[model samples]
Target: MSDPFDLLVIGGGINGAGIARDAAGRGLRVLLCERGDLAEHTSSASTKLIHGGLRYLEQYEFRLVREALAERERLMRLAPHIVWPLRFVLPYDAGLRPAWMLRLGLFLYDHLTRLKTLPGSTSLRLDRDAAGAPLQKRLTRGFAYSDCWVEDSRLVVLNALDAAERGAQIRTRTTVESARRDEGAWTVTLYDSDKRRRESVRARVVVNAAGPWVGETLLRTLSVEARPKVRLVKGSHIVVRRLYEGDQAYILQQPDRRIVFAIPYERDFTLIGTTDVAHEGGPGPVVISAQETRYLCACINRSFERQIGPDDVVWSFSGLRPLYDDDAAANASAVTRDYVLELDTDGPPVLSVFGGKITTYRRLAEHALDRLGPHLPGLKPAWTGTAPLPGGDMDGADFERFLARLVAERPFLPAATARRLARAYGTRLEHLLGDARALSDLGETFGGDLSAREVDYLVRHEWARTPDDILWRRSKLGLRSGRADVARLGRALANPSADPGAQRP
Candidate 1:
């Protein structure tokens, strides 16, 4: 490109990727830069639910709830492969909120979404229903509700991929060292994280979708006068062996009126989590504290007959929520889950986003683009709702049905391996596998549905620049694969010239 034509986005999280995808689709030449792997920050570290947070109703946030509800359905329609319907069993506790109050909240949640394929919320009898099988024989009444689950990191990648396919430049391992606005455009110098090299670009408008780093990106890098305050609330999750026997997930009530989720994850593991506490430090490399692990373990042990100690915890991860600093005196859990867009329109326009979720990213992008309308008068009207994300073009967002078609054609492949491929790549599985015949044709197996061919495909198409990018983010094969297997893939990838796909120019 001659220069950064129209816009330069500073973050590769969901908000930044979504904004870049939207702007590029609207005929603006754009560039998106990420300091690390995409979604390595707060965007990937989410509760992974695409719902109109039922608890937000307690704060009287009807507008945010309604908008998120609408986006939930919209995302389900667009990316059914990665985003699917999940039922959460909320066991009732008489001491906490009364059954009637819980019923009222459930009633609003049911009606908030324009009920389509997702089932409405219903009251359940813990003794009578299968959802209550894993719980202790305490408390009789409960509520089972529906929400959507998403692959958070993949969502960011898909947006970035879509943006790239539309002629937008996407640079991973690239950090914005400094940005300044000249007469009508932004002058930005970026340092590559891997190569330790610097490159520069100039654009008419700049977007700071840096999530938790939004404040620092403005204050330290851009040297802006006013920085939008954002609260960094830490939330953590622990992966334990699957506790329940069924597909349903449990939403447990804590002593402090907070909630925890124990959902089925990657076949054999149960992903449980999320304690909201005030965090003062930076967002990078935030790990689950020992206290957080204990809090989560205690929360799980309180409700279920199957007690899970620290030993039961196989893996743990934590993320910081860059929430908009709404003046709330209560705890971090009580802080608002809403997002805000701060625009600097004085000289060259700069739009900074604070506090958003994976559920509402599309709408957030559309709204962000709308805020920039005054600057880019020739921008196209907002249209992400009607467009399908990359690899989500399958009919009706139906993965199973699409998998059946893939299997029919590739009958030689194992059913489990094929299903895994179908879920991860959707209709693109055929393109990834590409006329391969037997198990041996897939090259070497790295255990748990991972193969050499799949690794090659990811490095070629999905931006797998690192081992963690392949093992954890692109897929959860690392949870099952052994150390030796990971080392094998690492050694193979290190010899870039020997690899079939080594970032060909």
Candidate 2:
């Protein structure tokens, strides 16, 4: 309700939500505004890993890798529900890099940081190991390593939720139209895209965590003098029918020395991605091009015997990586995923972030807050490293045991629904599925495993204002639901007040 906040973060992506949560926890009065849903632009489109980029060893980015590796464990401990450890099966190919080099990389990735909850990397013979069963029999050897799989969009929402819990205001569908220094504070005009309403906010500092839209948010929206140059790299993904038998994810090494992942997703499908190409246009409207579709399908077809064609592709999406324009002259994959903070301090400070991975958002937030230290007189020390994210209070963040106990407690919920709720809500699964005796009590099924009750919770609690926000971002139902289900959800969310819990102030 205040015109001026102590801090105003521009984007609602992972970086923005992280900064907002950090700053708010440090006792800064904060306000976060997103033009669309949280992670609508880029954050959710990530490969959804929270591991040290083993490939970055070639770039000699030891610092970034170590920090990312450490953060991966920390985040898994913080949000055990949305973030969990996953084993990546790096299938070996004779055409790709040698086994010794891959081993060296895995060795470094394992020893880069102090060990914690996750296990170390190991070698596997494809002929004997279960992880290799689905792969083309030509693959004889592989390396199994640990990484984290996160509900990328939920990471943003949980951070935003934690920020709000720490007394920050999160405004979705709100865009920062203009920001100007007035006296010693920032006068920011935020426009609501849905209501066509305008409001003003003031902040001693502002953060432009606008991901792919970072440059545009500074130049077009805020009219700031300082602009951090960012290179937009387009990456795309395709969802296909489950190709493998187990929950293990595949990391395919391509001839171009690039890596692609085939991760088990949404129970019945596998998620394969992504091709890196330079993109110089709008980020919001980015889509999977025909070439990208072919590229992904070809990569899978080459690796698997089943031959996943375009017809088997059920869903596809694209995102632009707003990389900090480092001096690398090659393609998007070579561009550093490391983030850079550009502070525009002509009057009221503006900290703009560029090019960060979902793996390192927490540390990125601490670093961003550190940059704002001179502006905020009495800011507290960083505390996110130890604090558990909202529902991640499980014993030592071991989600498997927690899920087992949850299912034991409520045998009524189907195994699939229980696992989904437990994964989505952690210890708070009790709250979401409270007193529901049967599937009917979970409310109307919206196709897939999505239910009306979960939709209501997201709308009332997580600020999901649109159907796609619920279907795609908040939940992965988009991969499972049909077009008719989406259309129905659209009509329902368009007038969400009709839902039992959709009313929000």
Candidate 3:
């Protein structure tokens, strides 16, 4: 048998990528395998907010709130290009939550974590602000607070990229067929979905962050009975034409007490969502149901000046949260977003992660490694907090300044193109753009602003192996790019020699 890896991470979502990145950075030999492309599941299908779950304050989850809030501050610095500060406008209605209670909650949110960069919350006169102009007349006043927005999928990719650069092996479109414990190590058999090849590797530890299939991975793949059950809660989101004109998002409180967000997306569309409902069936592609679309539209119509219906929904997505079954709350919305790490040290040590959100993923990874301390030899101390992610190591770590430099360096490129590349690739755009000074030098354009140069870069550096991987996950240009563009992009990817620089990692 070959030398065993120090750790093996299953799943490539934010949680798994964060763990692999953390472990690898500490100089541990790591290998992360995913059944599909990175963030092909719940990690990408998020409300894309990095903030303390303000509503969780009602649940009295003070610890979770504080931790998430702190992480929010850290991430804004860590990935400023992909993560930026945003203001959320919460319109007040005396019926849902009283003025006094809302004030107390916002006060707690502002003070729960030390604020160095983000602004604190304050009551606003909605009638005077543009935020109020888009709202219903009844909502005359509200509060505005700070949080961070993320390109959910890109966050996962950057983590995996940083991990790989730090000496971890990332294998996408690969599945662990079986994992059998032998002495102090695990013999894992992996199947490459695309190559139709099978191989086995040895690992001292297996970290299961398979998300919705955590139980299934333990039971079926590891041939062990699943422990610490998970409750699958399905969250759905809907997109529509821009509902209002503003960068500020809305946090509307429903009569049922659940909160929904309406945020700007893709510069031209409004993203609204999400409904919490218990999932009934087994593993499969989750989509927003007609009922969910209607519910979201109704929720938006309740707050926005321009009312919308289900028919107005342009796109929708859904993801299942593999929450650790606490059984403490009967309602899915009330279930804990905090994570639980269970380390089975009986024989071969296996760690399973249950119930976590994107905001707390970094902390989750740190805690996950801490659990394996006794099992790992010479494990390095935690260090991810102070380190910058891939393409995020900009001088001053300022996105706008770095963007100005990119456009300044490549004067031939369009301003919008440079901005998009900077947002998507950050410092790495230089590497992708190479010496190409003109649009013609960047190579053929495949619908929208996507170029062959960028496609080749994704294939070489990022694990973008298919058209869907390029059009949808790597970039959301698929929403605007036509079917013909997709077909052409597929053809472009197939002609490997076309670019000549597209080298697979």
Candidate 4:
């Protein structure tokens, strides 16, 4: 029987985290509950781009593209550590999209947003350029455009961290068992998995940003029945050993009219992906199928000089997108990438978020608040666009300069480790490193430069409870960690009291 909250956000994915952060900053008493770890689902499984969705233009989704493009610049400023500019090369083919069509699309992508900061698109002579080294010899002409890369899971956690700092309660591994409107408010029953206990609380408004589970949450959790407005589309990705020798990514157009991306990944690997297949099952555990693996390999083999097969895939993941059912396009790839917010006023106000991508999450939050403003009084104006996310307060949003400064300050750190820490924690590295002058001061290492000091920091501040939380989401060092490393880390987390000398900052 805690004090009633002003807002209860049920989901820890990007949208829910963003809404919680925005609402809390606006002075609302907010509570965010997630059934699993934050971003354990769709948010972390994204293609990890903060782009305008260049393909969405073909579907006539101009507003979505424009808003996303604008948000790209804002995110780069707000989280320069995790979001940065990336160049993508789209190679030309004799039979696929005409060169004129490619140029037109690039032109529109370049001009859609007035706040463009990245370099504009340009036609490339792939045969003579370094970008052409790995591509097929026939792919001579192409176009290069600008987008941005994001540490998707970290982005979600940072939003939740900001929300907590602003006085919002973020409860991970907590599930909303049921919610019912009672006397102009919502009585929510939450089940904390770790504690195996249930508690009841009240909320003035409920925001269902449950991502793929929006429909399930409505029917099973909230006892609301209505025609489903969400279309479940599953997208998957694969990671492999390094494929090329450049920082730029490639956008290969398939004969089926869909495009796939091959981007430089973790220093030693390449990331490829994203197949859109209509998901018929419930939103549960999903993995890349054999068909999908082959399809992706075939797509890559069609354009690249370095051919690969399913055997080359080192890792793969899949996630479901609960798209707003426009009910016009039957094909999953043709479905709109836009979002829809449905507000139900029959009882106490409840807002259900239908479809949204990682790029436009901030705007979605702003719009969610705007939609709820009439019911909730004394809310502050939108301010997230100008605010820096946690650890994103570097001067001028210049990550390189910040990295150089960090290296100069801590010359003891290895160059690679310094860059990784700089990119992951930004200005917060000062706090993490705290009074320490050497690597030994950071405590025991668990491979991949992961230290006990950093582990304690995550446990104390980031709501990290397990090895997977530290390995996969908070950082992607899991790719470099081995079984022994994971086991060691798990033991350390289970018995934190054993590390008597572990630094706590």
lDDT of each residue in 81-159, candidate 4, tens digit only: 9999999999999899999988999999999889988999999999999999999999999989999999999999899
TM-scores for all candidates: the values are 0.97, 0.95, 0.98, 0.98
Model 2: per-residue Cα lDDT over 1-505, one tens digit each: 4656889898999999999999999999998988888888788888877779888998898999999998987887889898887888998899789999999999999998895678888999998998878889999898999898898888888889889888988888888888788899888888988778997778889898888888888887767756458999998999888897888998888888788889998888899987898997776668888888988888887777778788888888888899999776577788988889998888888889998889899999999999999999999999999998877999978898998998888887779878888888888666677788777888888787788778778877788877788888888877667889988887877774754333222
Ranking by TM-score: 4, 3, 1, 2
Candidate 1's residue-wise lDDT over 342-450, tens digit each?
9987788889999977888898999999999889869998878888887689987787788888889889878877777777777667667877887778888776768
Name the best candidate (by lDDT).
4
How would you encode candidate 3's per-residue C-alpha lDDT over 468-493 as one tens digit per residue? 88877888887789889989988887
Where model 2 places Cα greater than 4 Å from the true spot, the runs are 1-3, 496-505
**lDDT per model vs. reference:** 0.85, 0.85, 0.89, 0.92
RMSD of 3: 1.5
User: Which runs in model 1 stand beyond 4 Å of their true positions?
Assistant: 498-505
Model 1's alpha-carbon lDDT is 0.85
* Superposed Cα deviation of residue 80, candidate 1 (Å): 0.9
Judged by whole-model lDDT over C-alpha atoms, candidate 3 comes out at 0.89
> Candidate 4: where is the Cα deviation over 4 Å?
496-505
**Per-model RMSD to reference:** 1.7, 2.1, 1.5, 2.0
Clashing pairs in 2: 3-202, 4-202, 5-202
